[model samples]
Target chain A: MSDSSSSFISNQVSDISPVQSSTTQSQRRGSSADQDDVILSIRSLCKSYFDAEILQDINLEINSGDFLVLVGPSGCGKSTLLSCIGGLTDVTSGEIFCRGKNITQLDPAKRDIAMVFQSYALFPNMTVAQNIGFGLEVRKVPAAERKQKIQQVAEILHLQPLLDRTPAQLSGGQRQRVAMGRALVRDPTLFLFDEPLSNLDAKLRLSMRTEIKHLHQRLGGTMVYVTHDQVEAMTLASKIMVLNQGRIQQFGSPEEVYKRPANTFVAEFMGSPAMNLIRAKVIVEAGAVKIQIHREDRAPLVFIEQAATDALRAFNNQSVIIGLRPESISDVAARDPQRSHSAECRIEYIEGIGSDVYATLKLGGSDVISRLHGDSNVSAGDRQQLHFDLSNISYFDPSSQLRI
Target chain B: MHSTIKRPRHLSCLLYASLTLLAFFVLAPVLWLLLMSLSSPTDLTKVPLQWIPSQWDFSRYALLLDWQNGSGKRFLAAMLNSLIIATSASFIALVAGVLAAYAFSRRNASMLLMFAFLATIMMPPITYILPLYSAFSELGILNTKVSLIICYSAMLIPFAIWLMKTNIDVLPEEIEHAAMIEGAGTIYTLRKVVLPIILPAIGATAMLSFLTAWDEFFYALIFSSDLSAKTIPVAIADFSAGRVTDFGVIASVGVLASVPPVLIALFFQRFIVSGLVGGSVKG
Candidate 1:
């Protein structure tokens, strides 16, 4: 299972188009010669309380100026993993190297890591300026310099008017900005955020997310952020690592994780309106492979794979799970003209979430959902023709659940 | 509509009556004490409690405050001793108990130690007095304010720690973690961040400890004999124990003894209500 999925992962990484692949290559070449580009490295990190393991042997490397997002469901240890990297949670047996210095045994303060917590964790007793400058004050920075730096950070976060207001007096977004200001004032080696935007309303979350991304771009600081929101992972991450049950399911660029997931878990977990897993039987017709999806009625729908990989060929006539995302079946998806197949099915219901219409239908003996255009005037019981993008489809072994 | 309009008014009338009854039940003794202190000797001894005094004699209070008088010096010294013991005991208990509570809350220190501290207070005061009396005598600190301070501190530390611990537990650990990650040390974090956030709890604990030490009688009765360390409560007991007891003087002393606590309670009621009592309701 590991062998096949690792091969799939490498294939996806190398499968980027000419321009992206070249720039990726050039970036690697430029960074390979100097170890300074490595901002944080974890070797065999594991965390457990008593006999209950929270994080397994985790190994990762973060480059300087990288926005790495750790995303997973609740209790997947993403925040614990971030805390380990920041020296808040001690590892069972591992070494954490921050900026090439071993910081596993170091104190959290000496590790020089700045973190913005989920609750904002702003000191309730202090004003905004006092809260932002606390780290400076604790470190015995001169009062004049601390004031200047706090003012500078306040200017950056546009918190000039709120400097004298306590956290209880500030709005949620303002408190969030103050938290960011606190982190920014320290100039720590790495920035950590544990679901820092989860507390805000949807609109504020979006604006804060955009502001954080812009701040990262402007400062070019290395950040390791933890969130259970996959959209945040997809939008903010240069490298997104999906975790489950204290293990990394997949770590790759957002496009790679979404387009070509390493395993069925990654395939299902990395997208909104998660990827659909359909039980299908593979058949060889004249030495070419086709998957017959068992529909509820009428007849079985068969889709052909013209460019089947060698890994897929190994499971020629066996039952496999066909991982199909909703967009792959939407009518608005670009047709490949040759490889994209179309099937007509009856819609069960339609849910319009303002931006897109999600139509639920029965296909391959499962309730499959499709992302349709918002203005599409289709209701329940209407027949609709959906297209399948073979290029976007993922094949998983039924028992092992690994991508082939 | 007519019933709804009239019901609240009738209900409020009943409610106010119940409230008045409860308030008088709690305050009737203090009010009677004030009347006894203000009445002349003949008025206090008269039958049917002399619901109204013939003359408002202020002579008992005058005698109590007269430093040149015989019992006046003892009363003033005992009052000073009570002040010294209660304030010092409260201050010491707060300092030590707050630190321990922080450990119990943030450091995940042994619950066994906390339970042991509580077990000391759980024991009856009579049980501690014997051993503590011997201990103080052997240590040559008998009849001194220091011995009483120690005893009161022992009695109050657990209460302080328990109150402080509960209040500290409600504060988010992430706040402290965030401060530590930003280079604040443990003591610094406690003094700056934790102390300020839990100030209400500290206020409540200090107020309760002072009140307890101020009213403590058994330890002061057994431990101190004279002007050196006898507190107000023990002195009041001595006044009542005399064969020819002056009810007016005793009432006046009782009234004077309660003044400090009443003033402190009024000053710190907001903290007490918002801190520990509020936590109990929330929990």
Candidate 2:
């Protein structure tokens, strides 16, 4: 399975234009030479609590100015991994290299990192300015310099008016901004965030998400962020690492992870409403690979062409899982024109979410959702012709749950 | 709607009346003690108990405060001893207990370990008083303020730990982690972050520990035989031991002895209430 994925990755790499590939190769060489561009590198990191293993043999390389987001469900070791990098939690095994230095066993303070926590974690006793300047104070930075840097960070975060107010006096959003300001004032090599926006209301979360993205763009500093919210992960991250049960399921660009998830878990976990996993069997017909999807009442023999069919040729006549995102399957008129497989199914439920309409229907004996434009008139109990864009579909081995 | 509003109003009136009656019963003894402290010796000894004495005199209080006399000197020394011992014991207990509770709360110590630490508080203090007395005597520190301070601190440490632990447990652990990431060490984090947030709990614990040491009778009685190391409770007991038992003098001493703790409670009542409620609810 690993061999096949490696080949697949190499093939994808080869498909990139030659000039772009050469530049990436040169950048890789430059990174290897000085190791200046790679801000943090974790090698075979593992953490365990007595008998329970919380993080397993994890490896990651984060580049300078990269917004890397580690996203997973609760207890999936995303936060633990972040803590390990921040030196708040000790790794059971493995090396953590920051700026080419082995810092796995160093003190968190000595690691030259700043972290913002979900609870804001502002010092209730200190005013906003004092909270932001605490790191500078601990570093024995002179009072005059600390004041200037704090003022600058406060101005950037629009926290000048809250300088005299303690954390309890500020609203939740203000506290969160102060937390970010505290981290920003340090000017550390890396910033670690553990669900920093999770405590805010939905509107505030969205705005903060945008603000953090803007901050990343402005500062161009390395960051390792952990969140369970996929939308935040997708919108803010230059790279996304999907984790499950203390193991990294996939690590890639957000588009790569979304379009070609490495496993069934990543496919289901990364998308809201989740990708529909339809049980199907592959069949080689007329020297071309096709899939046989058996429905509940009528078995519609829909043959879809996907680029991965060649790799899945050996699994012909065997049951496999087909992953289709909600947006990939839509009304016929809303589907992409390149390659679409159309089928008629009775819509069981309709959910209008202002901009889009989600219709749940039975496909291949399993419930699959189709996302259509809001103006696309469709209702429950209606026989709708659903067009599934097969170009971006994923195939996985039924037993192993690994993408084929 | 009218009936519902009226019903609550009537219920509140009944509740207030019952609360007032309970307060009167609870305060009656203290009020009597105050009245006794104010009455003249002749008026206090009168039959039917002069609830409101015709003549009030403060001569007993004056005598207690006259440091030139032997009795007044002993009373002043005892009061000073109580102050020193209570303050020292509570200060030591506060320092030791806050550190222990922080470790217990953050380190994820086993349940058995926590229960074992707490087991000391659950056991009766009298059970180990004999051993403690022997140890202090062998150390040649018995009947000294040092012995009483150590004993009182030992007794209060476990209770202080329990209270501080519950308060610290409710504080989000991420705050401490954030401090660490901000280049602050464990001591700095505790002082700047954890200490300030849990200051109320510390205040309440200190007050309670001081009161416990101030009012302790058994340890003070067994440990100190002289006014040099005796506390207020022991002094009050001594006041009742004289031949003919001057009730007026005893009441005066008792009233003075009760003042410090009452003042402390009144001064820090807000912190005490919130700290106790925070502890119990989190537990």
Candidate 3:
């Protein structure tokens, strides 16, 4: 058991060596050269209302053309953070630098940031063309120039046909497009969106999301998008910052955050159906580690020679949380022989959603769902052997709630 | 389909019946006033009430319009005074009230301050008449159009603020935030966005303020000694006070005085309905 675990660790170390060296080399160069590309930098940002803190110690650096999304549950301060960046809300304490200048005390108008609100905020009294060109008008741009710019933005947003219509006359999606046109016409240093797609129906929301992503690609401007929808963050962001309870849970590329969440909150928050958390005890036996998961009315399943034994050494005989996404577990027939860890459990229920099936099973006295491709042959009350992919499993310290 | 059509016919009959009833009750007074304005002096003094005058005499209207007759001169001066007072007072109140309401709607101003402004509206104007008269006299502006304008504006400003504030509150704050982000200052946002959206409500409020100022008799009666500053309401009241009261002339003055308000209301009827309902619903 010890030999197999050690071999796996050595293989992972070898695999990461080249990538690690390149990353460190880039880090050395990034310190100075990257500073110029940092379009926005927030340092020690804290905001409070009365005695209650709303945001704390928020430090972030957004680079040029980076679409950074602040995502969390309701009341998690994602919108507040976006507001601080846009200079709409004054920070309680902290400095925000935009284009290498501190804009902490600046007015929203002076900040050179455009924002698209959830309500679209298109002036109801103004025509689509007027709404799109309003910022230019405010800047005192000449009428011809403003018209040309509005034309350009309207063309890009496919709003040419609706130019003369007021916001009330346009459909919800059209209104959102006009809002995008308004923001785009400014060509500001940064763009802030506060749950801009929340008001649209699901179908429109999906299309609008794609449209925004395409716009981001075409414009390549720095934008900070705030949303409670993790799917939006996953799809739209170049870097996703997961916030929970006014603090950052994780900030990383989508793959890094999804595959390796920093903590339990992120693990639960980032994925649909969420990561399945199971309480298990670690046991050290003869220089190897085994996980003991106890089940009610059944024999305990002891997983031997887990690959994470070295990291689990200190946690021997102590409770640790095992996080596995639904896709990680599958029926025995569908499991890859070389990559899966098999376990026996009784199927509790089955939920079929079109192309896939989800089997609910009792494992270690907890309900664990296994996602299977096509129809799952397993039925309720059937004792089934489920295979869990070992490589994507996350281990967390129960006390600290941090990933091990 | 047949049942649906039949039901609508029945419902529409009931609707039309109620609407006719409402129209009669509403227009009866105006119709009666019109009849009186056109009645001969002898016809007005008859013991039996005449819904339709046997002889229609428009001489009273002609007398009210002409500046030659003493009563005509007094009526014209009072009408002019009412016009000036209503227009100026309503304008002043609207301008100050819109600015105050915008400020009150913002987060910086405490709710207590809003309530304080609203508290002024809760007090009846009659309660402040004596103090206002003393202040006006002390300022040496009594019996002047400016004094009446000031008094009317002061009386109506609180109401304007309350109505405008509710209407402004219903506007999306995000629109203001969007404007601010677009390099627009507070004043610019108000001018370009806020004002246009709330224009209908402002029109409604202005009409209301103008009518209130135009109809106010208590303050005008106490402050003005003659036709120089007295409004239509006071002038119409004065018509009944002589040894032999001319009911036809008095009714003529009342009808003339009502024309401005009635015309303004008719012209802005659409705005009035929307403005009144605007506060309770989002745009």
Better of 1 and 3 by lDDT: 1
The fnat of each candidate, in order, is: 0.66, 0.67, 0.72
At residue A192, give the lDDT of candidate 2.
92
lDDT string, candidate 2, A197-244, tens digits: 988999999999999998987777789999999999999987788888
Model 3 misplaced stretches (Cα beyond 4 Å): A1-36, A309-311, A332-339, B1-25, B110-113, B124-127, B273-283
Ranking by TM-score: 1, 3, 2
Worst 10 residues of 1 chain A by lDDT: A16-25
Candidate 3 CAPRI assessment class? medium
In model 1, where do residues sit more than 4 Å from their true spots?
A1-36, A332-335, A353-355, A375-377, B1-7, B270-283
Candidate 2 TM-score to native: 0.88
lDDT values, one for every candidate: 0.85, 0.84, 0.84
Which number leads on TM-score?
A: 1
Worst 10 residues of 3 chain A by lDDT: A1-10
Residues B1-283, candidate 1, lDDT per residue (tens digit)?
Answer: 2554555778889999999999999999988999989988888888777967899989888888888997788788889999999999999999999999989988889999999999988788898878888888899999999999999998899999999999888888888899999998899999888888788778888889999999998999999999999999998988889888889999999998888899999988976666543332110
